[model samples]
Target: MESDESVSDSTRPVDSGVTRLAYHNGSWINADDVCLSSRDPAVTQAVTAVERVRAYNGRLFELDRHLDRWQRTTKALDLTGLPSRPSLSRLIDEAIARNGAWLARQKEFGVLWFATPGTADSPTLVIDLYPIDSALIERRTRSGSLLVVTSVQQPPSACWSRNIKVRCRLHYYLADREARQTDSDAIGILVDSDGTVTESSIANLLIVEAGGVVCPPSDQILSGVSLQVVRELASEIGITWREQRISRERLAAAEEVLLTGTSCGIWFANSIDRSPLRAAGPVYQRLRSAFEGRVG
Candidate 1:
């Protein structure tokens, strides 16, 4: 056991080494100084929309694409006070520049923006940049991941477009908790109401078959920019990629399953619900290299 003074001293900030910055409304501030109202709808009612992008080796990858998605989300969600696409892009670049130390220390960092459905008087907007820990990335890349299916079905997209990313995520939280009951580092996969595999808790899913890479149709899942980019890369490399509704059965039968996201890039799943899916293989390596080569 550690002494209380030792614990308290440990809690105190020493040479923490990283500098963080935040952007809100139209200006930049220290990340720790930013705040959200407890009564805001985005907080109280979970009506926040978000877009997360990456700065690879000091450059933002696909800035136009992610900002384009944010534009659509703002329109569809009726958000306000958000900056224009050009302004948002500049703001992210500014964040990276202002947090120069953090950027210098990291080969990969994340730039995440949030738009809250604020009151008639005001709307909330925020952008933050932080380093993506190399250890977590290494763990997923080295051995792949363990995923478990859960009873908590993904909210049907028919009710609302699955393209919109929101913070109202209690179902996903619970599903992830259930996955932790199985393994500490495990992640949860959500099936749709119709027994089709839709996506994982935070990232999109793609499973490889004899034909090639098959992902659920965008109608059923978010059309992730990373997913689209990888498919284009596959085509450039002469590997076929298609969008088809993947049933739970099809996923279980897959030779390899991968999760895609901006920060994660491409990661493999070693198993899903005790069913062995191939670990990182030649195809996974090829796509991963293609992605890294483009962004890195």
Candidate 2:
């Protein structure tokens, strides 16, 4: 066991060779110093909400949008002891400055915001930064990603609305693990109980057809900020965007499949469950170019 005294605060920005600083509750501290008790709800019950914001070109992308979603999720989960909006915003800026030297060396990175209901005293709020996996992004961009449809079904809305992003994602973990059993590089895509394609473990799925791009209804999947950006970009380019329930057969027949998330703005999918689909089709190429232009 480590002694609490050894975790004493540093007078200057703290760095452990890997991470620089982190915000815990209302104070900025060493990344490793942010700890939670084993009994905390975030650990014991998995009652935590998280928002991952990507910093592109050293600037946070869609920060307000990410923060809005985080607020909605924390409120839906009734998480308490959160900092006010202004305070949280200022802390984010300070965290970036604290990690400025490290961040400057990387092309892109991620800002993770975590909130959890705590013991009797207070809630847990933390902001941490991490480097993006450029190698993985490069590989996926070249060959496209394999999305394996997993046996694990998405939890019903009765459990919690799909709109609220929470840490209760054992299903996603199990699904991804099951996918890796088939192919080490495969990512898992969960389906509804009725066999409608919902989303991948960490991204929203978009299907391209002759008519337009189709997305899963908001009621069935977490509305991703990246997905919204794609929608806007598509509209600007005169591409139609619609929502519908996508069955496995439709997914197999899709002209192209795209994945959108905070870290990866847009990426193409090569196949699903070993059935090869078009990789980086014309639609995907155009959207990807547009996305890159937007980010740059």
TM-score of each: 0.89, 0.91
For candidate 1, write residues 73-143 as lDDT tens digits: 78888886677788777787787778787566655567777888665577888888655656777777768
Candidate 1 pairs with clashing backbones: none
Model 2, position 236: C-alpha lDDT score? 90
Q: State residue 69's C-alpha deviation in candidate 1, in Å.
A: 0.7
Q: After superposition, how far is residue 232 of candidate 2 from its true place, in Å?
A: 0.7
Clashing pairs in 2: none
Top-lDDT candidate index: 2
What lDDT is reached at residue 109 by model 1? 67
Give the per-residue lDDT of model 2 (tens digit) for 166-228: 888888888888988988878888999999999877788999989589999989999999999
